[model samples]
Target: MIEWLATFLTSSPKPDLLRLVAVPVFAWAAYRDVRTRRVPNRTWLPLALLGIALLAWDIYRASTGAMIGGLAERERFYLRVALSLGMVGSLGYLFYWFGGFGGADAKALIVLAVLFPTFPAYMFPNTALPLTRTTVGVFSLTILSNTVLVGAVYPLFVTLRNALSGHRAPIMFIGKPIRAADAVREYGSLLQTPEGFSRGGLDLDALRMYLRWRGVTLAAVREDPERYRDPTSLPDDPAPPGDGSIPDGGDVVGPETTDATASGGDEAARAADSTVADPADHATDAEAAGADADGYDDPWGAEAFLDDIEGSAYGTTAEGLREGLNVLAAEDVVWISPGMPFIVPMFVALVVSLVYGDLFFELVTLLV
Candidate 1:
């Protein structure tokens, strides 16, 4: 064991150290993304800077003839770095612009390009690192490919789970039926509405964001459903003692306010209503007054509350929220797609790339 450890440590100490440092950081980012569907932009800054510094150091070593390779090897190293950064960076941005990658995911790939422009070679007792390598040897590109391959397994798992549960509908593979009461507390998007299932679902994360922006808890809204349903209620701001007037800047519902929140709400409501017929009447007034809706009440003031908050943030639009609210208001059980955070797969790919190299490349090589 000691001999093996010594060999591993000696075989690319700098690259090994960087890989070790990255494991914990990527783990943290993945955990946060799973829990909150967000990772702060600042999360990547330190890693990005460190990657830049390391790349610069490598270049300096090559230029000073301290690196093992002579002039030809030095020029090759420079070319590799240029190709990796140029190709990987451009691809990352294009993915983001085309909506295939999240901002953080794209940044992760770019930073990876800076960090590991070429495969970091290592020798172990049983096998060699990077079992296969392409001519360009863009490590970031390899990571991206590996990530996609690793992520493909999740859909199969979802499909199998749904099938075992007797939900054979094609849509069931992507999402599951969850109680409407649990919707606010969950992650993912609503896949069902009052009318039926549709692919263009409402994002629950946006609903959570709107709730936070209003400074009101979903629990509180559930407790006093009618209070929130009223257009005049300003829960985020309290009135002065013995005064009924709403405080300034409070989200008061009125014609003047229609320009911002209400207008968005109207548009959202129309969009939501477009696909579904008028909601069915199945609940008593008493049950309708509650948050659970029981398929009778319109989502207790969901549109009005959405209209009271700031214009959309966190990928939420008023129409989406309105559609989601309509479903939540009108359905007891709604199907939701619990999105898999791409960072989780990216982290797994990073580990696999470090130890086994690109699995996709290896498979292709084996076939050929």
Candidate 2:
């Protein structure tokens, strides 16, 4: 069966093995990288090195076996090989620059490129050729086939694994991110989460951002407590009150007139707010106390912070942060975007494919 299959493929009997090896090898590496955010040197280095070695061997043989039959002859065949690899290389380069792929992925691409120049396209009945006068057909099909296969599987895998682990990222959006309680009883449909509320989890970016903001917030409130606090004053601790600074309730309050014990700014106003003689005069103190009940302005600017900065590459604005969060929340995607709208290797392929597909093609895309 293997011999028969070999005969059924390229008359050259080579790009087939190269393609066969390249596909699953690269596919597994690529998928693993997406899942673990790592592209091991072992897989990537071997693919790139072996590919180059094969291409080199093909080149040496082609030069001596110059009698191989073809219309354009040896020079053109070699040139065609270069073109095929070139197309793949160029796409990989762009993705790397745009952060869609890593250094290892870029190298893997280079390995794939050499096959065409080193071997021959007729190696697989693969009608792909590039930059040369040869039709732009094969590039398109490969890209389309690849996109459908890779794009669907990787993200689906990421989502399922993350969700199943009950990993809900920390949420600090609320006045105080409620530890997403296990039983959110609207009427009493005890739907509980396996994992209890977390500040947020599994997202390095948000955690980084949270830490930065928390430090800034603490410093700001510490430095400008009066400006941040609503009452403009805090209840004076009789003797070096607990912590020197009164607990400024969450919200901002106006200057208080009474609560002699209200906010500080007095010589004889050290009496308890309730003990004050003129309760009516204590209106400012009452208002300040009320405001404390509400949450205060985020001195740290946490309200506007967002972890997904890449999505902004196309255009993510401040106001759009809400839209971004809403999308994350709806999809239950935690901190990651549902559409990792990367610089898909297929962008170039799209144009190249359109050229050939219009000239000649038919495809059946099966989402499953």
Candidate 3:
């Protein structure tokens, strides 16, 4: 069985063999991403190692002039492959650093850079694409361009769907509205603001600013010093939520209280628990107590954001969305992100690039 499997993978025309190998790998990645919204390193690391070995072998062949025909062409091909690998690796790392590329995506691009550096001659025997020629052997860029182009079509499809459905919100082009209750049940992310809550989405910039205002940085929080406590541990606030940011305090009526006296008693009870549950909430309550004593409106007295739920990448909790749902009790719907997996488009792009040699490049050439 091992011998037969090796024969099947290696016996075909080089292009066909490459496709056979790639399809299974790409399909698996796409499937895993769709199911888990994450790609484990175990899925791509072996492929990357395989790509490195193949590229090294290709280089050896080129250096020794062991080509069956057109030695010069082979050398150029290997050189282009090497250069493309370097360029893609550098850019992928940079993009990952800046959050433009997800972890799986950056690693996948690097693997592709090593594995499919050139347009497979067998797949497009008589191709005359100028972009192909310019890229030398680097087909991954073309694949990326083609992938983006193909992915763009889905947004248009969603827009048309929304238009036909009579959903007129402009933000519907990027995302659609659903019930906040359903969003919580389905683990969907907020796409828009609800009443009494700050904007629904996690604003990384705002979070950074909030941390800075509290005299803490992400580097410090991530390092997790014994004395650091939390990112929002300023002298004023003293302690914040687990994510190091303050929940938007508004008129939140807790179920345990009916009148101001009951709410105050509940707050006292909460102060006792907050030291253990969340010091930040306790601090906010202390501040609210002072404000109430001074006859000022207390934002922290509401306790609407108090329910704890699992945390998300945006640092908000399910409890936060639940609070938003409470505030939006008058509204029927909310906008949310369904967590689109990008690997699906990447898989499509891989197949498209293999068969068509870059859709974007072909369009550009036709226009020229």
| TM-score, one value per model | 0.74, 0.41, 0.62
Cα RMSD for candidates in order: 10.6, 15.9, 10.7
Candidate 1 residues 1-368, lDDT tens each?
A: 98677777776546436656777888899988776667788988888888888888888888899778678878888988998889987888899888778788888888788888877777667766766676657787788889999999988888888889887775877888777766665667778655678867777766555454443444334434444443333333421111112223433232222223323343333232232112232233544434343432433345544555434434555556656665665566778887798899999998899877888888887899
Total colliding residue pairs, candidate 2: 14
Candidate 2 residue 295 C-alpha distance from true site, Å: 13
Worst 10 residues of 1 by lDDT: 238-247
For 1-368, candidate 3 gives per-residue lDDT tens digits of 67655554454345435434766888899887665445788978788777767666666766787644486688678667776677876777788888677788888877777777766544222232222433445777776777788778877877787789887675767666665323322323456554432346633322322233333332222223222232122234323333322224321222221343223243443332222233344445534334345432323222222322123324444344334423333345766555455677878988877656777766787899
> For residue 228, what is the lDDT in candidate 2?
25
Off by over 4 Å in 2: 2-15, 85-87, 99-108, 116-141, 144-336, 340-368
Q: Please give the CA lDDT of all the candidate structures.
A: 0.66, 0.38, 0.53
- Give, for candidate 2, the lowest lDDT window spanning 10 residues: 182-191
Candidate No. with top TM-score: 1
What would the per-residue lDDT of candidate 2 be over residues 54-119, giving only the tens digit for each residue? 767666666778446654566665665656666667877887888666566566555556533332
Error of 1 at 19 (Å): 3.9
Name the regions of candidate 3 deviating beyond 4 angstroms: 1-19, 68-71, 123-135, 185-188, 194-200, 203-331
Better-scoring candidate (TM-score), 2 or 3: 3
**True-vs-predicted CA distance for residue 312, candidate 1, Å:** 2.9
